[model samples]
Target: MAETNKPTATKGVLSIAMIKKLIGAVVGIILGVYIAGIGVPEGLTTKAMWGMAVFICAIVWWIAEVFPDYVTALLMCSAWAVFDIVPFGTAFGGFSNATIWLLIGAFGMAAAVGKCGLLTRISLYLMNLFPLTFKGQTLALMVTGTLMTPLIPSGSAKIAVLAPFAAAVSDSMGYKKKTQGAGGIFAAMFLSLGCIHPLFLSGSFMCYSVVGLLPKDIQSQVTWTSWFINALPWGITVLVLGYLAILFLYKPEEEKRLASTMIKDQRAALGPMSKNEKYVSVVLVLTLLIWMTEVLHGINATIIAIAALAALLGYNVIDRNTFKSGIAWDAIMFIGCIFAVSGVFSALKITGWIGKVLGPHVAPLLAGNIYLFLAVLCIVIYLVRFVLASQLAVITIFTLLLTPLALKEGISPWIMGFTSFVAINVWILMYQNAQYLVAFFGAAGGEMVNHRQMIKLCVAYMIISIIGLLVSIPFWKLTGLIQ
Candidate 1:
């Protein structure tokens, strides 16, 4: 329940954004109606045409923010069913996906952890370990965020938890809003919190969505440990290069040491861990242990996550209100719809048609050289991020279109999928990264860091992200992801 700084439409007000959304909604409806009425195009079925119509509208609305993403998702599935583009079961199949439940379970656990302040105490304790200087605090924030990454499921949730502490530290150091010191602190926090998501399966909901989009056989092969192992090379590159990049890009106005009590006071404010904290800790740790050891136990992560959530609730670590409020139901709805949309896309043959249309031009690039293919793929997604406000949408669409070509090139589709996921996570522009924006304007508050400095960090992110994927090519080849 951390407050987000996303802009809202005021009643009876006609903001430029609202005007754009209205125009987008009307255009979306018109485009959908026109596309649907044009009859089946060559190489596409009537169902595919209908699916395209729904998709066009959904994409427009999604980019326009015409509705909550979950609401738009619901509309997509309902339209599919109403138009008979797919069966009701197929249109809504994402709800039946175990990935959806896993996300739910993860959110539940995150809620309990946040609600009980365990994450806060841990973060402050870690930050307090470093000397109070700008560089020290920056490193401390990065380490804290990275260590906490695997434990918390949501990147935004982690930002919400870390922003206040970062702000307090900045203030203590006399780094005013928009100053270099304040900007550095917040930028480091955002980078550390957001950049490493793809390194862990449960690190972001987007990771689960990526896995959900994979072929069933591949999905079966991916586990928490396996995902970590596969992404380690890229993750290490990003972590090392990204941290160095931050230090190089931003400098503090002064090198003043932090007041020792600033971080210590925050840590001490929590006093002793409460019973809820202890119980939630135990459940989360045990769940993570199970996830990491999935190869040995042969248990699915979803089951472990569900069990962990159940334990939290069963042991009263999460109260009824906490369960209802803590879990990100909107994320669940949106993620489920992503799965459903992917299913509908396949069922209607849209995915295959998309692959066919784009395949010839793209296949040549992917056919002979894995490194060349990855570079091209990363650049494409990075450019696509310019117009597409939704990172998940970009990841899903590119993965769907190029996966076939990757497979044809004797490459594992996972390389394509993971590469696209990393590429799309960048935010060179302010609007490109929603979670970063929310953290900057929401948790970190607009006063801490200005857009100029963050954009510099974002440019660094764009370069680092692409390099991370390209450098991982060797390791991926060693792992048989590339032949």
Candidate 2:
């Protein structure tokens, strides 16, 4: 209905999207010029003030949705080098960063898995292991998504692979659009895929990006095994609590069993694994094993991932087209640009100045009490998400401001960084989570589940995420992350 009612474009009349772009453009340019005109403040360099202006403009354009995120990122990166805020190599240095390569390699592996029908086959096998009841189906989806997390690092990629299966399951069960059963299946899949990302370094590019934002010394310590160990308790708590929330909020009208024929039939339809599937499975397993054993081998994670990509290409498991289309180049550009932006921010001493200015005001609430600090931090991040469209922005800003204080209080900066990542990832609105939007509109086809029911799941996630973080304090203590 909303789509049908959208006003058509006409000469001399602008659409809402166009109006947003215009306003964003005008506001961004004006602010950038005005800020640049201001004299550099005490204790901050001239380049830092200009960097702030450019960063602010880019952020405004991003929140306004003026252009694709990658485009905005491109503009920011170009601005830094053009304005001499940083050297050209420094401004564009993220392109050569190891973290960027890791993401590129991960996306390629995901593409191979997705293209070979392995992801779909695995999903069906997982779902078919359970009963055909509504509760059983929803639980199956949650479990499948969790299990798939390690194999597929990108949440959007996972949703792309699983959401269609979820919709098919909903239809097979006689559930219609906006129906409780259908909504439950989607809620379980989307939320479960989202919440478990922090548990593994390869779980999502967001995890890798956040870790990249940390200091170099801290980055070396946060390998795959240590990340899982640190995040296991919190990740498990959120997954269980979130599943319970879905079951509670989207109860089915009846408990009758549905047909399992569709699931079993689909699994059988594949007949046998092709050579590509076998090759992809081998490469994926070997890559994961190498990643997990990084402590002993002492090889960088990026090298292993690049090697996996090479193996896939060498074996012809994925062709040149797959190499081009399979990787999320836009995400790669966006993340790389963000890294450059953050580098400039750090070099300009902007973060230290922010800490100095805001530290005193935030010190009391955050002082000496790790629990209180976390609680307050979570609440602030929750509110910030309402306006900040980019999760990376939220993570970067909060980490810069609060990490110094956290370290001063005998807390690891990883705790602060990881908590902020988790808090910002939980969303109660459609627009807040881009990955969820992709799942809803792409996999679910914007029909299998409706916004009203999904909102209930989102609210549940919001509350449960906070509870999960709070519950993990004891575990963090045991790990010696807190004094």
Candidate 3:
């Protein structure tokens, strides 16, 4: 490759940013034309160009790490609107979606919980329980996380809930935690993805709410009871299985934190739970109860969560700044932007088009063969984890497109829903999900294993989990064990 020192050509109007935008436009035009030639989306060159442009830019922003993911998302939305990809209102209107509000409100509740030291207190209480054996301690942690995930749907929330606590446990036990980094990572990963557990219902708030937005017939088959029943067994099974797998696979080289890293030294600092902690605990339980019985209570979990915050604020337990500090705004914007752009995908029915393409190839394999279809779909969704880095992204895109196709293929919608749920969390390779790697690496994602090793590990995980699911599925069907 050759290098140049002089400035590159600018736009005809002559400005650096204008030149980049022109380049983006030109690249979009070329790619759109090529896609039209190859048959992904047909006709309407203008719309295709704009859609592909936002898509391209979004990917580039992530690869470049030029800005936060949410920034990239908002820019994608702006690009679509500015380029007239869809009606301006259509592009921006989804920002006001009730789905988005629930996510935002959930973020607020997570923040409030954190500021009140409720998560630490809760996590410590969980960690400190059970016998001193590794088996007992691990089981306790798994139970604590399983119960917590649905209420805090964000994977990041799980990380916040578990990472520090895990680190603290490692410290308290005097275990150096080097060899068992994978175990630590695995424990945290469960917190991130285990929200679909049976505690709430047939589905997670996000999954159910997204699915609920479907037509009533589809919605009826995927109620809370049904989804929770179908999913929780596998969800709980996978988490426990994965946890035990890590424990059996590795142990710390030497105990660094065991029996030495506790607050046992500082008698004055170590005290019992205070009144504020009790108050937040009550608020959390009430919020969860209200959330689970949304239909009967006629009030959403979000309002209850917000009310809890207001109550905290009223009593000056957590002032505005503390509360504000608790919120993870990146999650809100990132999820919201992705949801809004999903409107464009909805507007263009892009997933529908992809469905048309895959339908023929997939139908024969799935026809009259629920086992083959379910197994293949799970692997495909699992392999898809390699391509998509974020669990939420995988769930959103996969469920949006695959659920409808699965239904159309004569596979039970409920079965497909369960398969999709399993796929999102079953990824075992280090790189496939950031939440898995974050604890191991000490950030969201800062490390990598070679592609070959990653693929092999993922394949092993995919094969094992699929086999387990297959053996268990018959039982699930016979006893009507799952939702």
Task: Please name the candidate that would achieve the greatest TM-score relative to the true structure.
Answer: 2
Q: What is the C-alpha lDDT of each candidate?
A: 0.75, 0.75, 0.53
Q: What is the lDDT of residue 331 in candidate 2?
A: 59
lDDT of 2 by residue, 266-379 (tens): 778888999999999999888777765555677776887789989999998889998886666665677677667556766777755654655566656767566777778787
Which portions of model 1 show Cα errors greater than 4 Å?
Answer: 1-18, 37-41, 133-138, 144-236, 244-258, 366-373, 381-460, 469-483
Q: What's the TM-score of each model vs. the native?
A: 0.69, 0.71, 0.69
Instruction: Write down the RMSD of all candidates, one decimal each.
Output: 7.4, 6.2, 7.9
- Cα shift from native, residue 393, model 2 (Å): 11
CA deviation > 4 Å runs, candidate 3 = 1-40, 43-45, 92-94, 131-137, 147-203, 206-237, 248-257, 260-268, 368-370, 382-413, 424-465, 476-483
The runs of at least 3 residues in candidate 2 whose Cα sits more than 4 Å from the true structure, single-residue gaps closed, are 1-14, 37-39, 131-138, 144-194, 197-236, 245-258, 367-372, 381-462, 471-483
Candidate 3, which ten residues in sequence have the lowest lDDT sum?
442-451
Residue lDDT tens for model 3, 207-234: 6545643546867666556656555555
Q: Per-residue error at 181 for model 1, in Å?
A: 9.0
Name the Cα RMSD for model 1. Answer: 7.4
